[model samples]
Target: MARVTKPLSQTEIKAAKPQDKEYTLRDGDGLYLRIKKNGTKLWLFDYYRPITKKRTNMGFGAFPEVSLADARRRREEARSLLARGIDPQEHLKEQHASALAEAANTFSAVAERWMALKKTKVTADHAFDIWRSLERDVLPLIGALPITAVKAQTVIAALQPVQSRGNLETLKRLIQRINEIMTYAVNSGLIDANPIAGVRQVFQQPKKKHMPSISPEQLPELMSVLTTASINLQTRRLIEWSLHTMARPGEAASARWAEIDYDAKLWRIPGDRMKAGREHIVPLTPQSLAILEFMQPISGHREFIFPGVKDPKVPMNSQTANMALKRMGFGGTLVAHGLRSLASTTLNEEGFDPDLIEAALAHIDKNEVRRAYNRATYLDRRRKMMEWWSEKITISS
Candidate 1:
């Protein structure tokens, strides 16, 4: 015998008083309003499990927040899932879990995970540079979007401004970095496809730009002007050190007194400071050692061999040598980096082993044919070559 259950009227529900114990008012179709002893009213749906045929309670929301019509709509939706052999309660749980996963899979979150793995492979300084570059150029535009939602067009739009500024080199690296992150996302099962795969084709390819430099023959004039230049003594010494050692401007600026070994006549720049991200052993020459001896009294107590004029605790300004060169009437003729070029030209012309000269400059020979020779730093053989280079600069006139 089936009993017909009448639908609950809004007025009847509104008039339903709260009892001392919890009780329910049915609106039929497995929908009901539960009134607790505490006088809180909540909407609940009861349903039989599709597989096990067991009953379970699922909460819709609370009333009067959820009106009478809203509960009916939710009951019909739940029943529709039942007809499809799906348990509505379990479906809601799955939806909840999926939402949590998607929220944690934003582009920035995934990029951070990728960087965590990448940090182990590169220098700490390099890792910091990569992250800062992303923060400045990549993150602001698309960082908030979910990794799954980052399409080729989304990446293309973000990189166009960097390209517009003619930062083709930056654009190139950003595209590669973004693609690496997408690959990481794919490998991590965050997304099915890498939408950022071919986004680089949208931008212009960067042409190789060389740093401005002077000829090797003009070394005497540069040295002469550098000697007489009104710049501070430390600035003059730093420029000569870079020229003598064939080290980069940044490397010379950050040189530490602790890195020098007087007995061994070596300056061992750590992997973090080297451009190739490997420890570089520069065999010190008489000229380079003399420069170190000259600076011993000035920066003896400081950490950096060439400490900043304004603050001795920090490394000297990397551009100090550039400004001194520029101010000394050598503007547009040479920059601090030009010393490596000048050294390379003269040493190669002097019949020095190309590999030894490249090693002196700490250059990673990218030519496929010469990559086999990349293993050794050539510490012993490099000593004589460095001495010759230092002598050349001192006696060029």
Candidate 2:
């Protein structure tokens, strides 16, 4: 008959003192507390492998860190595994490996990996905006958690700050970006499902405001300000160029000298630099050409047509033209982008063909087949229309 050792009491375990050499106090079965000479106590389970029949010891945790009741609970779990012909040490090894893999597949890790792939697909500025939104709103809250553990509610809670600030538009865009990343995670086998699916329904839709611009009646005044404002020559040229071509302020501010074709009378914006992700052809009006020619003497040495005043290597800040407009007492009454609206409104009122007007604006066709057709058919009319528009501005001024 085998002698059964009594289970250890909380008082007995706490009262036990370390001696000169390392010694162990057995509880029952294979559970024991090993007391070291340095007065440190460690909880361990001594077990035998069912397959190899070899003896092994597994450390649960240090005493006081892992209490007696918790140690016993772990010991019972190990015994249950042994009774099922499983080795506890091997099972623990598998669990550790799984935990390590989960840690490597955290939301932050997968998001960064997805972003690396995205940098190739989107423009540098677009990629930077996405990364900045994630860093500011999403990652700090739950980025360290495993991808599988992120729930839809967790994501909603993470965006509450942005929502509270009444930046519904930014919140909507941030959620869409998160969905893209989670979808990438699903496709990459890092997560089973996208947690951000249907998150748009969680927030109230934001009211859409048409970008502010001056009325047609204000165009003469605007043209007058651009012609005579006490602003930098480069800034005045950027504003005039944007208005003449109906290009976005950013496109005008970041224009490069290499994009111009002096003979073709075309300013060919590359696909990557364009918002539509397609190359845009701006038929340079005589006015547009004169503006570029004027800028050549001042900015010809730099790559950018509108290089920063402080740094020639970089393009001028996109907001510089807008700030100049604001400084000229047109802050709320007009904006740089309003130039496009102004052109669209004036051209429509002037009885120009709508298709010709849209083509001159470089507005992309929604239908792919139609867009391919229109791009080929509209170039000549677009050039004629742009020339007329420039003349109209010149005469109106």
Candidate 3:
């Protein structure tokens, strides 16, 4: 028969002092308080492996940190694992690994992984902007929460401040971006469902405000000011190029020397750089060529035709033309993007083919079959239309 040892009492365990040698005070059922020679008290569980039937001791923790009662509770939990033929030590290790994995799949962690994938699919500047918006608006509120715990109401709460500040457009984009991230999480198997799905309905629709633009009748005056204004020469040329080509201000501002083919008479914007995610060919007119020629002496040494005034390494901000227009007493009446609207209105009134006009603007066709056909058919007409448009603007001025 096996000898039975008496269970230790709390008073007796506390009264026990560390001796010259290490010793253990056994609490019945494999729980023990180890007293080290250095005066440290540790709780341990002595058990046999269910598989190998080998003896092993598992640490519950230190005495004061994990009290006697807590140690006993842990011991009982380990014994229950043993009864089920599971190794207590292996079970504890699996639990620890599961906790670590859960920590790694936190909202911030998963978002970073999703962003890494997104950066590959967008322009560097666009990717940076998305990251900036998330860091400023979304990350602080719920980035640390578990990805699974994120809910539509939680996201709405996060965006409330932006909505309250009258940044409805920004709020809308943020919600869309959040939805994308959450969808990525779901597809990545981090979560079961997207918390941001249908969440946009919770917010008021953003007001539609078309960029303010001058009517065709008002163009000559605006063109006159642009020609005569004491703005930076680079800026003046940028405005002329924007008007002549009818390209977005950003497209014109970020134009690189390599993208321009003087021989081909085209500015070929790579698909990744274009808003439509396809290559855009802007047929260069004499007026557009003249602007590029004028830019040669000033900015020809640089990559961007309109490099920022303060930082030549960076492309000029698209807002430069808008701000210049505002300074020229056309604040609410004209914007940089208004140039496109102006061209669309004028060319349509001039009875130019709608297809040619759309091609000139690089607007993507909704019908896939028609778009593929149009891409091959409209270049010549667009080239002619662009030249005519440039001449009309010059004649108006």
Candidate 4:
């Protein structure tokens, strides 16, 4: 065997370059450098297992990328491993596998996976809206960046366009989803932290809230105009059900005949159909029951409670209720969401428990304790409150 030599210096190694062939110089300490025929040089190390009488070769990296000093430092690490009876080559393979797994876990890939898993459980319209926002606002900027490289500044820049247009609600929502995606990336070990964590502290500017609803004192006249309006009968019933049950328009429009127990006077909305992802039981007041009875003649075994006029397979068009209000000269004065606001505010003013009012509207409180206790505590009070609200909204000609 050739005698081991001292580790070569960078200047000495370059001087010893071959004219037409590759050469590898080994320092007896298991580190070496290979000068390629094309003049491309790389650092490498070699070691032997005394127990198995086997040789292992390792590539430190290409020259300039891994300096001569770094190569020797790695060699010392491998020697330390050998001293502990560990196989350096096997250790490197394990490390490479972990790094590869982390590299594959990026923001875009993780967000897509989250969407795929969540889409099946939400409304088709809701799912479409979320994916559309991601494609338009979130994806173009940071989708290609690795999760670890996604700084909070990147998040603010991604949402600035949405904020510029007075879409603060959308901006807030987008930040939430981005935070969720980053959190998923962190949990998967692709990133060290959620860049969006505590981002709200930076966006100190408050969102412009939607205009509050018309007072209940104004609701009587509003309902009267809606009753005789030129809208479809289905739209009329939707408005009534929305007000009487104090449920969301989306929930009312998509209510299935099967979910209603007319005899029990309850409408059981499935967890998947709700924004809160919890099953909600809406009590059908006498007025709400009357409308359901009126709809019974038109409702079919294979249709929505408030079926789309042109397409019975789907719920009524999202614009149907809002358009009804506009045609009655209540355009910007009212919105479908405003109806929920109206109910919550009006009910709270009437001395009802805030928890019961929130439950009647199917609003999700973010407080863990509130959510945990209210899920079971408020059903009876909510049923009574909804019944009273229905009585108050009736046109007492």
- TM-score each candidate: 0.87, 0.80, 0.88, 0.67
Ranking of all candidate structures by their lDDT, best first: 3, 2, 1, 4
For all candidates in order, the CA lDDT equals 0.87, 0.88, 0.88, 0.80
- For model 3, name the residue pairs that clash: none
Candidate 1 TM-score over all chains jointly: 0.87
> What is the Å distance of residue 62 in model 4 from its true position?
15
The sequence of per-residue lDDT tens digits that candidate 2 reaches over residues 1-397 is: 9999988988988898989999989998899999999999999999889999989899999989999999999999999999999988889999998899889989899899999998877655567768988998889998999888888998998988999999999998988888988899899987778877998898978898887788778888888877788998888888888889998877888899999999999999887777777889989989999998899998888899999999989888878988999998888877888889999998899898898888777688788898889889888888888898899889878
Error of 3 at 71 (Å): 1.2
lDDT tens digits by residue: candidate 3, 1-397: 9869898887987798999999999888999999999889999999899989999899999978998889989999999999999998999899898778678888788889989998777655577778999999999998998887899889989999999999999999899889998999899887888867998898987989999998988888888887789898888888888999898888888899999999989999988777777899998999999888888887889898889999999998989999998999998988999999999999999999898888888899999999999988888888899999999998988
Best-matching candidate per lDDT: 3
Residue pairs with colliding backbones in model 4 are none
Candidate 1 lowest-lDDT run of ten:
368-377
lDDT of candidate 1 over 318-354, digit per residue (tens)? 7899999899997887889988899999999999999
Winner by TM-score between candidate 3 and candidate 2: 3
Candidate 2 lDDT at 140 equals 99
RMSD of each: 3.1, 4.0, 2.9, 6.9
Ranking by TM-score: 3, 1, 2, 4
